[model samples]
Target: MNKSLLKLTFTFVALLFGLNTFAQDDFQGKAYYMSKTTMDMDQWGGREMSPDQKKRIEERMKSFLEKEYILTFNKSESIYKEDEKLEAPGSGRGWGGFASSFTGGPKYKNVKDQELLQDQEFFGKQFLIKDALKPLEWKMGTETKQIGQYTCFKATATKVVDEFDWRSMRRRQPPPKKKDSSETGDSAKADSDDPMNEIEVPKTIEVVAWYTPQIPINQGPDDYWGLPGLILEVNADRTTILCTKIVMNPEEKEDIDKPKKGDEVTQAEYNDIVTKKMTEMREMYSGRGRRN
Candidate 1:
């Protein structure tokens, strides 16, 4: 075996031995992550927009694109949530308002139990999404790097994109030109009436993660986990989430509780509910446009 692979193997063995001696109840960690997503302005008609107009749009969507999160974990369970901050008046008004409905609340993951629960508030209604933890068949590599004070190993996986995950969504490319021009005007008018026609989500995305065996806990921000150690960074599609700070066994630790204040539904059912609501919204807007 290569030197890097040998070293990683030895570390894994040591981690396995160490876990048995560790105090699971008293041991806890809090990881602070900064999440940022890149948006392609050109895909969203940026070429025709002036610099000021584009800046305004970006400012309005800033909260949705950039965020901070905290992951609190023990050996088997963890709660990942956004570090909420008060926004200025009129902030997050247009596109941000639309995205907020899909953004979930505190997410609880129990690795030992293979359980996942998330709290979501959609259009003034609460939903608790209950489901099994989505497993990733990660291909581990012998590559090594340093993140903060820990030695990190590289791992990769292909994730099936969730239909409602807006991070992987993009504007659909315009349709090809047709030889028959008779239906052109009607097609354009119909497409303009429904906003959902412009959006598209990819089927899959490549996920790259860096994990440190030093922590020896299978926990990560958002929906990522199952590594041999704590995942310190995740680069998936247009979004990147990196660990900025880690607090191990702080004096005051928050309880890792599963949210129970919403209508219980599975992930698939929640997606269907959102899809139906969005379709209804599209029809309402289309009817209003016709009347005008």
Candidate 2:
């Protein structure tokens, strides 16, 4: 072959080889999640409300409880977020409203590094919570279930959590017990301890998850992860997050960037900061109401 023709042929062959290699190492994938939150609003006046009123409340709550999320992940890292208002079929940015403040935020997890970065917003303040991934002592089970054509295995874990335990926070103040002559030192010491303090401590929450080894990725939505495979369903504290769809290696892979712009704090620190600010706001509004 002539020199010019040989050069052209070599370039074409190289391009084909590059494309073939790209096809082999797929790497990137996206998982769509839909979260369902079942609320028992008894303390919030659910018991007093009529059936019609309850139905109307439930209808209004559909938008808040049923949320769509997308997790774009590779071998070691993944970004999980809520679907934007007008996101295309598979694309979404998970920044949500006030409801999300009490639950979660846009999280980026690197399983290999055991690191997590979350973009959290409370009221109007933005927070970038950087923390180690929450550890779960997952007990893998032998049971199997089908989740969207994928065979998934059951796993259970117990987590110490306080975020969703509203019942403990609402325990009726115990009535004063008459002091007995025999009940002096230890019993008095117990009474001196505040009941609210005990309830405020974190309690153990059971987490049930189903994962599929077919995907060969250690990833899941929110703080639930560290499984042997990709998690398809998670039931935690009366909330369920299910993976509805999965797409691998799209035509154009979008860049997954770490969130940077916000007040940097650990997950616990952020929660404390938010809780303090909210308490202050509530006290301020209550004061205004009294004056009015």
Instruction: Give the TM-score of each candidate.
Output: 0.93, 0.74
* lDDT (C-alpha) at residue 184 in model 2: 79
Model 2: pairs clashing at backbone N, Cα or C within 3 Å: 82-94
RMSD of each: 2.1, 12.2
Task: Tell me how many clashing residue pairs each candidate has.
Answer: 0, 1
lDDT for 80 (candidate 1): 95
The segments of candidate 1 whose C-alpha lies over 4 angstroms from its true place after superposition are 13-21, 93-95, 180-188
| Range of the 10 consecutive residues with the lowest summed lDDT in candidate 1 | 181-190
* C-alpha lDDT score of every prediction, in listed order: 0.90, 0.73
Point to the candidate with the largest TM-score: 1
Report the Cα lDDT for candidate 1.
0.90
Tell me how many residue pairs clash in candidate 1. Answer: 0
After superposing candidate 2 on the true structure, give the runs of residues whose Cα lies further than 4 Å from its correct spot: 1-26, 86-96, 162-202, 285-292
The residue-level lDDT of candidate 1 at 172 comes to 92
Per-residue error for 72 in candidate 2, Å, reads 0.7
